[model samples]
Target: MMNTYSFPLSTLGLPNLMIQTSDGKRPVNISEIVFLESARNYTFAYLTDGSRVITSKTIGIFESPFAKHGFIRINKSIIANLSYITESCKNEGYAIRLLNGQWHTCSRRRTSKVKKVIKQLKTL
Candidate 1:
């Protein structure tokens, strides 16, 4: 059996990630971020409200920092918020559907890791 605990997302010590914009910087809640896509020289954080922030940080920087915040690298170019992964389908292929009605294919190399994380989340 898995050990279950009552831990909120904030208790994980995940910070309110800030992003730079042409105007200024904006504090973003983790829950608001749907995923992040790596750009040429910057990365774009896509929000639940259909907004995005382009920053100079690389995708690698985000991987270590936001790992405990329910964010996972589903692919080389994508970092998805695991908390919002509402459902998964493996009939045709492995993919996860988000609460926002978006579906992303889990990379072949990361499919098992993603599934393990999901199982751990259930026992949390």
Candidate 2:
């Protein structure tokens, strides 16, 4: 039998996870897991509302292979987990609306890339 321990996502030290067990889904805590393409490393974190801190990994090393599935590269330093996104509006600047109803701005330079990936997600 596999041993399991029940704990809040925060206790796991993963700061990018934005989801919790609710609405009758499986009780398995869903966390944002990061897989780096360059270094081939995996890091996990939890997202508390809008703010999140990912595990220690060089910014340039990790790549969101699932970016087309909601993960977005917001800037050179971080990737936003779109699983938490609720709404988005591209009026003057690019911004992401999280499920918690929080909006985070994406740098102008990364807007195009983020948009491209998000668009692909829609088609899939």
Candidate 3:
């Protein structure tokens, strides 16, 4: 069986970085995020638990913080957590497969960055 995982907000090393979800402010562990996708004016955060949360903030709103937490912005529409990526997919352009089996493609400009991040993760 796949191991179930969870982390309380207080235990996360981040200080006061909270994600505003539908219910209210939720303390999200940065590493728990599998990927993020932007749809029109909203951004959806997809987590490893297979739960998706909508955030009113734009995808760019997360760039800085996510970068500090192992997230690589692969394209204008998608940002993925390096820890959750299962493989580097070159079949269709440049893409990555998450542990949860979700695929995200990188834009031409960001492909090198994704490769660098994947290499960094392997070294760690």
lDDT by residue (tens digit), candidate 1, 55-96: 888888889777877789988888988766777777655777
For candidate 2, which ten residues in a row score worst on lDDT?
1-10
Q: By lDDT, who's the top model here?
A: 1
Q: Distance from true position, residue 105, model 3, in Å?
A: 1.0
Screening candidate 1 with a backbone cut-off below 3 angstroms (N, C-alpha, C), the clashing residue pairs are none
Local accuracy by lDDT, each model? 0.77, 0.47, 0.75
Model 2: number of clashes?
11
Residue lDDT tens for model 3, 9-98: 222574445788779998766666788898878998887799988889999988887888767899999888776777676765887777
TM for every model, in the order presented, reads 0.81, 0.49, 0.81
Candidate 1 yields a Cα-based lDDT of 0.77
Ranking by lDDT: 1, 3, 2
* Residue-wise C-alpha lDDT for candidate 2, range 86-123, written one tens digit per residue: 55677778776654444667788988886776665455
